[model samples]
Target chain A: MPSLNHYLLVAGLLFAIGLTGVVLRRNIIVVFMCLELMLSAANLTLIAFSRFYPGANGLPDIHGQMLVFFVVTVAAAEVAVGLAIIVALYRTRQTIYTDELTTLKG
Target chain B: MPLPIFWLFTVIMLFGAAAVVLLRNPVASAMSMVASFVGLAGLFVGMNAYFAGIIQILVYAGAIMVLFIFIIMLLDLNTDKKRTPKMAPILGGLGIVIAFTIQLIGVISTTPDKAMPALDLPASAASFTPGTQIAKNLSANSLPDVHLIGQSLFTEYNLPLQILGVLLLVATIGVVTLSKKQSN
Candidate 1:
C-alpha cells in the first residue's frame, strides 16, 4: 500500500508541472491543455483523500468522489465553451498566440 | 505493502505531464494530456473510485480532448508550431515549481484527519420513513459505486444536479452564439 504521502506527492508534482506549462507556454491552446492537467491533479487528490478516509466502521466516504464527478462535469462544460471561444478568436485574429490577441488592451 | 500499479501509473502520469510542457505542437501537447488523464484514471481505479476512474476516461480523455483536437483542426493551428520561449517564461515556470514545492512539503507534513462536514447522508435524515419504499431503497447499498452515486446524486444533490444541467444548457447556447460564423 503506497502511503498517503506518495499519492499526495505525485499529485502535487503533476500540478506543479502543469502550472509551469501554463506560465511558460505562449500558445493559448497548450495553456488550456495544461489547465486540464491541473484539474486532473485536483481530481486525483480528491479520490485519494476519499479512499483513505472511509468514515466510521470502514464504510467508504465517497464525498470526495462525489465532488470529483461535479468537477468533471463542470470541466467538460468549461472546455467546450472555451474551445469554441478560442476557435472564434482564431477566426477573427488569425493567430492563437496569447501575446498577439491584445486588441482589447488599453 | 506498496501497490506497483499505483507507482506505474504515477510514473506514466509524470512523463505525460512533462511531454505536455516540452512538446512544440499543441496537438501533441493535447495528446499528452490524454495520456496523463488515462494514467490518473488508472490510479483512481486502483484506489477503488471506479466510477470516477471511468468518468475520467470518458468525460475527460474522451469528450474534452476531442473538443480540444477538433478546435485545433478547425483552426488549422498545427501548422504554426513555435519554439518554446527562452528566458522570461522559463524563469516564470521555475518560480511556479518552487512555489508549489513548498506547498507539497506543507501538505505532506500536515494531517487532514478532521471529519469533513457530512452531506445529508441517507441514514441521517428524517424524511424517509423506515417502511416506505423510498426509505427502503435509500437504505440499501451494496457498495460505493455507480448505484450509490446515482442515489446520492438524485436525492441529496438533486438541486445542484439540476443547476448543472442548466449550466450545460447555457454553455451550449453560448458556444453556438460565440462561434457561429457571422450571419450575412
Candidate 2:
C-alpha cells in the first residue's frame, strides 16, 4: 500500500512545480493558475494528514477535510473577484503581462 | 491492487501538473489543471475519503476549472504571445537541485519515526459509536458522512462559517463595483 510519505512527496513536487510557474511565467492568468496549484498542494497535505490520523472519536479527523472545504470556498470567492479585477484591468490597459502592468510601482 | 491504483492516479496528477505549467495555451493549461483535480479526487477516493473525493471533483474540476476557462476565453489574450526565452542550462540545473533539496528536507521532517499518534490510530477509535459491535463489524475505512460534516460545520465552527459567509458577501459586492461601468 502507498504510505503517507508518498502523498506528501507528491504534494511537495506539486508545490515546487507551482513555484516554478509563478517565478517563470509573466502572464497574470498563468500566475493565478500557479496560485491555485499551490493551494491544491496544501490541500493534498491536509488530506494526507487527515487520513493517517483519526480524531478523538473513531472518525478520521474531520478538521483537515473541513479546512479544505473552507479553502475551496475562499478560493472560489478569490477567483471570482480576482478575475473581475483582471478583466477590468485588461479593459483599461489592454494587456495581461504582469511586468507591463506596473502603474502602481513606486 | 490499491497501491497500483494510487500510483496510477499519482502519475496522472504529475502529468497534468506538468501540462499546466508547460503548455503555451492558457486554455490548455486550464484544462490540464482540471485533469489534475480529477486525479486528486481519485487519490482521495483511494484513501477512502469518498465525500472529499466527490467534493474535489465537483468543486475544483467542475466549478473552479470552468471559472478559469471562462476567464481565459473572456480575456482574448492573442496580442502578448512571445514565449518566455529558455534559461541557461546551468540555471535549470540549479533549479532542479534546489527543488530536490527542499524535497529532501520535507522527507526528513515527515519521517515515519516522527509519525504522530493522531494519524497512526485506527479509524474506529475516533468514531462516535466505538463501543457498538455493529460499528466494530463495519469496514474500518468507510468514508465519513456528508451530513456529519454539515452538522459539524454548523455546530462546532458556526462562528467561522458565518464569517466566511460575510467575506463572500463582501467579495461579491467588490466584484460588482469593480465590474460596473460607472461607480454609483
Candidate 3:
C-alpha cells in the first residue's frame, strides 16, 4: 500500500501543475479546466488524510468524504456559472484568450 | 492499494492534467480533464470512499465534461495558436510551481504521520447504533459509506447542506441571467 506521504506528494504535484496552467495558459477555458484540476487535487489530499487517519470507530474519517461531496456539488454549480460567464464574454468580445481581455485593465 | 495500481492511476491523472495544459484545443483539454477525473475517482475507491468515487465519476467525468464540451462546440472557437510565449509569465509560473513543490516536499517529509493505517483494520462494531445498517456493516468488516454519509449530512451537517442547496439555486439563477440575451 502507498503511504500517506506518497498520496500527499502526488496531490501536491497535481496542484502545482494546475497552478502552472492557470498562470501560463492563454485560453480562458483551459484555465478553467486547470482550476478544476486544482480542486480535484485538493479532493485527493483530503481523501488521503481521511484514509490514513482512522476515526473513533476505527473506520476512515467520514467528515473528509462529506466535505468532498459538498465540494463536488459546489464545483458543479461553479462550472455552470463560470461556463455561462465565459460564453457571455465570448458573445460580447468575440475572443476567449486572456491576453485580449484587457477592457478591465486601467 | 497495490503499488502498481497507485502508480498507474497517478500517471494517468498527471498525464491528462499535463495534456490539459499543453493541448491547444479546448475540446481535447476537456476530454483530458475527464480522464484525469476518472483516475482520481479510482484513487477515491482505493481509499474506500466508494460513494465519493462513484459520484466523482458521475458528476465530474460525466456531467461536467459533457457540459464543457457542449460549451466548446457551441462557441465554435478556433483560438489563436501562434501567440509567442511571454517570458515573464512563463518564468513566474515555473518559479511558483517549483517553490510550491519544494515546500510541499519539505512539509510532507517532516510530517510524523508517514505510515498509513492498517489496511484491514475493522470498524468498531460497538460505536454504531445497534440494529442499524451501519453497525451491521461494521460488524461485517465493511464500511457502509453511503449510509453513514447520508446520516451525517442530514444530521450534523444539515445546516450546511441546506445552505449548499440555496447556493446551488443562486448559481442556477445566475447562470440563466448571465446566458440570457441582454435587452438594450
Candidate 3 local lDDT, A3-106, one digit each (tens): 88899999999999899899999888889999999999999999998999978878889899999999999999999999999999999999899999999899
Whole-model alpha-carbon lDDT for candidate 3: 0.90
The better-scoring model by DockQ among 1 and 2 is 1
CAPRI level of candidate 2: medium
Model 3: runs farther than 4 Å from truth? B119-123
lDDT of 2 by residue, A1-106 (tens): 7777778878887787777777777788988888888898898889888877766665567888889889988998998898999989888998888778888999
Per-chain TM-score of candidate 1, chain B: 0.78
Fraction of native A-B contacts kept, per candidate: 0.69, 0.40, 0.85
Q: For all the predictions, what are the DockQ values?
A: 0.52, 0.50, 0.80
Task: Give stretches of model 1 more than 4 Å off.
Answer: A104-106, B81-86, B110-144
Instruction: Indicate whether candidate 1 or candidate 2 has the larger TM-score.
Output: 1
Name the candidate that leads on lDDT: 3
Over the stretch B1-184, how does candidate 1's per-residue lDDT look in tens digits? Answer: 2478878898889999999998888788889888988899989887767899899999988999898888888888878655555787678678878988897888788965343233334553234356755455445633436755777798888999999999999999999899878877
Docking class of 3: medium
Pairs of colliding residues, candidate 1: A1-B1, A1-B2
TM-score rank, highest first? 3, 1, 2
